[model samples]
Target: MSSIVKTNKFTQALSDCIRSNPKFKAGQSYADLSMWTRLCVGLSDTEIFSMLPIALRNVWADEEIHPLLQERGAIGTGRFNVQSLAATLVCFRRTETQNSEVRVLQSQLAHLSHEFNSLSFSVFDILKRLDRLEAENVTLKQALNIGGLSDDPAGLPKTETQQISIRSDQDAVTKYVL
Candidate 1:
């Protein structure tokens, strides 16, 4: 048989298989399937039109798409067979699903990353406040120590031990004025 005849038969068979498969029929329109086919194979319109049945067969028979095609009972041989084409379509569909899932996951990761940055800033601010407070506490403790106050066993200043000192010169001035 001529290669052109085989290619047409193969294309028809693939179309039939897609229509018969409930998942394929429900998930994509003919136009959508066509577009996806081109996208998945990264082929131009002229290249796709001129592609041989063997080339189409090889695409579906790839290691990635073969197993899925077999699971769907769409594997076949010959120019009249649609199994290869059906497999290619299924593979494209799977790729689309995976791409969508990846997008969702990426979005979630971005949100989480943002939240982590915010939390880090908050923690840093808290640490800075704690350090400032610690320094102030140390300075206050030193001042209390210099003011003739002793820290009790409970870590508080002993207020009863505090005494006011008066200079003798000031006392004599008060006596002279009186």
Candidate 2:
């Protein structure tokens, strides 16, 4: 099989793969490396990638993407290559999978993740405020010499008798900040 003369990092890797892997010793060949010559054929890789759904676009630079594709694109510079997209297209086309549904689901998941993080931070802030208010409540109760289960009916776990002991008519006069 004829080897590609226009060698680059991507082509070299493909040639190495053809030579080393046992399954390709007869079926595939260095001739396949010519595919890399069209890396930017009709349109720039960015334009082609932008035309694709996010599912295929992910193959170029995702941390979870295969090493070959990750190497083909520059994540820092947002550079992409037709070789990577073509490889990804071949893999997906074999399964006859639709990428639009995948892209929609991924978008929903990302949105949910962002919302969950925002809600988690809000909940954390609320808990901190509650703790501060509880502390303040302690000081006020101690200074006023007040005691009651009615103060915080949901206080520490208690036996029925303990529950009865802390209640008082003073619940009517008590002021709670929470």
Leading candidate by TM-score: 1
The number of the candidate with the highest lDDT is 1
Residue-level lDDT of model 1, residues 1-178, one tens digit each, is: 6656655555555454444553442124565475446443543334344453454466465665455556655435465443444455666666777989999999999999999999999999999999999999899878888886655455554355332223455677899999
Model 1 stretches astray by more than 4 angstroms: 1-81, 153-178
lDDT of 2 by residue, 1-178 (tens): 1112322333344445433533332111233323322332343344334433332333334443335433443232232444454455444443333566787889999999999999999999999999999999889877555454344546646887866665643453464422
Give the least accurate 10-residue stretch of model 1, judged by summed lDDT: 158-167
Clashes of 1: 0
Error of 1 at 79 (Å): 4.5
In candidate 2, stretches whose alpha carbon ends up further than 4 angstroms from where it belongs are 1-97, 146-178
Per-candidate local distance difference test = 0.58, 0.46
